[model samples]
Target chain A: MATEVLQQDAQAPARAATLYHIENPEVENKAERFLNAFAAVLHFTDYKALLDSYCASSAKCGRCVASCQVYQVSRDPRDIPCYRSNLLLDVYRRHFTVGGWLKAHIGGGWSLTDALVDEMADIFYRCTACRRCTLECPLGIDHGLITRLGRYILSMAGIAPKALQVSVREQLEGETRNTSKLPEPALVDTLEFLAEEMAESLGVKLEFPLDQPDRDYGFFCAVSDYLMEPDTLMGNAAVLYAAGDWDRWTIGSRNFDAINYGLFYSDWHLERIIKRLVGEAKRLRAGTLLIGECGHASRSACQFVPVFAGQDELPVKSFIEYTLECIEDERIHLDPDIVTEKVTYHDPCNIARSGWIVEQPRRILRSFVKDFVEMTPHGRTNYCCGGGGGLVSMDETHEWRMKVAGRVKAEQIRATEAEIVVAPCANCKKQLKELVDYHELPCRVMGLHDLVLRAIDIPGGKSARQRQDEAALAATA
Target chain B: MEHWLELARGPLFAFTFLVMGLGLARHVLLQVHGLVTRKGQRLRQAPWRRIASSTLSWAVPVGHLDRSTLVMTTASFLFHIGAVVVPVFLAAHVALWSGFLGVSLPALGEGAADLLTALTIVCVLVLVAYRLMTPRARALTRASDYGVLGLVLVPFLSGFLAAHPTLNPLPWSWMMLLHILSAELLLLAIPFTKLAHVVLFPFDRLSEVHWQLRPGAGDRVAAALYGEEAHV
Candidate 1:
């Protein structure tokens, strides 16, 4: 029966109403009201005008369709980038444009129905907003922007995916400072546990400095890294410690998590999250803000922080760039023999395409790895990890994420024939891990710093076991 | 027929140019106004050089066109080149420009212009066939798309027939009048239709700041709609 249902869904891509059954009448009414309010907002006129411009000039060249992973995998007309963009474009035309007004008086024009709204919500969310399609589009029509706008409009209607909505709300209004809702005590415990693990394995005691004021750098990472990606956390601590910059760096009790769910859904949430990051940096009195291995978070802080938080404030930098700087300055020594496996790097869309942090990761990887192969189209032109634009966070979209969006990336990785895939972004790491599992690829997925931790040598920091063993030998002497 | 040709060459031509020029100016001015009025934090510096380079790169088939869609891309490229180059460089067009604008630009030879006109017509036909045949293209195709293609083809076809009056079915004067009328119609339709892209394409490409996730003006739009929440 489940297989039968899946087959039906595969056949009918436009049946979004059946897919997402919003049963509550009150909720539906509220959503509709919110959608109306969003539409009525005067500032949206600019978007309407932009949409109008697109409608006026769009050639429907279908160039973007060839580049779209979802469309390429699904082979569904509805999955085409232009077709997806037209969902919102149709809405803008129906109500906002002068042509729309004329058509309304003349009759036989499109009207925004509940089903159409539901369809827009359904299709828009399916896109990862990788903007790969935008690079190829002759008209420079950003289908990713259109998808985001459509999702934003639908979100206003309260028709957003529950996973994204709940997380954004929690980050903004919940007890915890981050989206993962990790409490202060738990965060400290997690860091300490990671340090102990590192000491046990690597013969070095790693310290996670917290809330130390007047630090040179304040480090922020995805809150999920504490629970799920302990190795990544350890790697970060290990690199910082090896660089002898541990004393100058600190993570604050508040705003330690750099993951911003807002960049995926709401501008309101994006602004709020960015404000928190800026406020946390100010409170810590850090000279520079360093974002951990999370692409969207790094992009949000690096690109939007200057705009939102003021240019004169603490400079935002990616942890990858910091690591590269440390390497260039010889602050940390790397033993290349530590990682002998064939490796390739996956460029996170936010990092490469959006932020232009392309070469830093490659330079770091080259410094350590014996053999580093590149995917067919690496760097700025690289495909999304199929988990970009918050798709990794949307658990409900997992099946679709793996099957449709992830197909291209899985193929890209498989083509490289690498033993290990180093994805710098936490979101890409998670998505790549899933791709590895789903595709049954032999490669292991890891963070850039994971490789760094394996290869890095700390001068004075010794393991507890080594220290104990040395003391016993001295006693025997 | 002679009277109609005289009117098309004189008053009608001037009127079409006026509308095309004014419409293009208004469209460009509105976009500029949008950029100026947009609120929120702006980029520390505009990436003018990168934008110009990116625009040039995107204008050709070398970098921007995907390999899978080469046929359509190549066809589109040929059509655009012919559409722009042939019109600007044709001896007749040069003569008109010399008379109207006091600019006696170099002109393409008759044979070269004829060959380009033929290639452009063939390209347009191939594009129209692809639009009708391909499922994805068919899905995106509208009456306006076909109308634009046909509208463009008319001037090219009429111009070719006028150039070769011996082989033409219609009278030389009538063919000339049809060519002028069709070209005028295309010019008039520029701002009102997809032809607006001809003028807006450069601004659209150059205006986008590549480093930022959203366009530079995007934050202001967010602020205007979402209020204080968007402003931080």
Candidate 2:
């Protein structure tokens, strides 16, 4: 008789039922539904090769154990990266491989079941998909990619976190065609308001151009920024004005939202979101897609755009890169003495984990900030703010994100003791802001653009104090 | 018992070696199939120098260490070194390979082989103890993990003892037979198990280079799930 090792833990505590909701009714049981999803995911994705290679080679060396923040906090057996990966890999081995088939026939192996599906639903969501563990694995087993694969398959079964599912559905199929369901008029009004605010505060008229054709750049920001990060949008407006002429960049009224929740869960949703950005870029007649301070959204376009478009139809450049270019080309001069508060940057995992977009932001920061501090392990291998992988959107998992997932990150930030944490990615900013508040750290989180806005030498723009000081100096002379 | 020992050393040894060799080849071929051009997917040209350098870095893995990983990574580096060195270069083992295949490989001297064998045993012990003691390692370990390590250590322990009978507690024939059987079991198991990382390591290290985002796939999957009107 086969011994069922995990069948006992099949009843393992899972918030999956609340988290996962499926509309499909054809499947007989949850196991069958999940297996069907696995087949579908396999059919749709080129992941069989990755799965086969990883299954054969992963040593489960526990080198990743120390790297995983979740494992460190929970100490749960399920949180181990390799062990969690095996939860899905075990199914593939048993069902897809010859040895596993033989073992199953001889009554000596485990199989995918309803309990295991529930367990995966619970555990897969807990991971932030930061890919820090991938950097640590000497064998190059991408545990973060495995988490994504698992999440992708689960999403197929309709067993995904409701927060992500809802947002994706809205972004792909809703009335406004964005995650937050913000209307085009509302976006227009917000940009107008931001421009008016910049004009009032800086004593110069700044343009927030929208739906303008034949522009050099089409800007896409995490839609949530319009609602919550107006300061960041204001900064982007000022910097773009200083960097390029008014006719150069425009925000598409239709596709200004850059946050792709699909990246966190479903590929179908991720691709759909990218397709909209491509369309938006074309609508603006853009030479490039300018992504704002959103981590996963930038990665979705930077990496996936080439994959989906089959050619680099529109070059994707992060706003950080664009700003650095402005600085390099002498188009914009950031006043280094302007920012006196000790400021440090948090590298969002999506942009930096692969060593892309890591250095440009630092160059931009060091150019302007008077007191710049670097986090202990800042670039590429930086810790997730616990709200990554779309946990930031879900109110239900907030406690878990704060207490367990965000713990290490909180410690990292506190150690920096910097007054300002400039998170270039919108997701990191949201998570880090909440993280500091939760941990009661003195640090405040802002988008990199938010800090740069204060220092940017906007054309003909100077504060009243600057004008007053100049007048006083002239009088004294 | 002597006849069994001879068979274990000759045809059975050849069979197990062939199995491992063929299985590893298949793994390499499958990985190549995955890594190379796929029909529906678009493959990006990965930066060749970076990949080469990155794969080399893992071999020595001197970078990417901190307080958290320094001790464990050091043990792993030592363990991998001994794991490869002792099995391939042991003087007694090279003779068998040379006679069977007519391909003579370099051999480690008696003192070197013994020292490496002892090192491998100690590293394996430290690793095993980690699994048994640490909750995370225990969680990560399956039964096969222990089985594989135990399989690897048996030959080193028994062969080391058989060579030095003064230190050997078991009878000579039993030690030789046990060593041969355990070695054969390990060889048969390697191709079919995680020990195949020995060959698959390079493939895993370079997996990122070829990862693609196939166009139309998302639509294909979505339509399949939610029908023709599935995707927006």
| Best by the DockQ measure | 2
Candidate 1 lDDT over B113-179, as tens digits, reads 9999999999999999989888878767778889999999999999998999787999888889889
Q: What TM-score does the first chain of candidate 2 have? A: 0.93
Instruction: Identify the candidate with maximal TM-score.
Output: 2
Clashes of each: 1, 1
Query: Per model, how much of the real contact set is kept?
Result: 0.30, 0.67
For model 2, residues A1-477, the per-residue Cα lDDT tens digits are 011445676655553343334334233587887787787777877778878888898898888877888888988777778877887788888877787899888976677787777678777887998978877788888787778878888877767666677677777788898888899889878878887887776678766888888888888889999999888887887777777666688888887789888778777887788888898788678888989888899998887777666553789989888888889999888877668899888888898888888899999998878788988777877888888888888887777888999999899888988999999877888788888888999988999988877777766778434744665698999
Candidate 2 CAPRI assessment class: medium
Off by over 4 Å in 2: A1-6, A12-28, A463-477, B1-3, B37-41, B47-50, B64-71, B171-174
Clashing pairs in 1: A203-A463
TM-score of each: 0.91, 0.93
Taking chain A of model 1 alone, its TM-score versus the true chain A equals: 0.90
lDDT of 2 by residue, B101-135 (tens): 88899999989888888888888888888878877
Q: Show the lowest summed lDDT stretch of 10 residues, model 2 chain B.
A: B38-47
> What lDDT is reached at residue A375 by model 1?
97
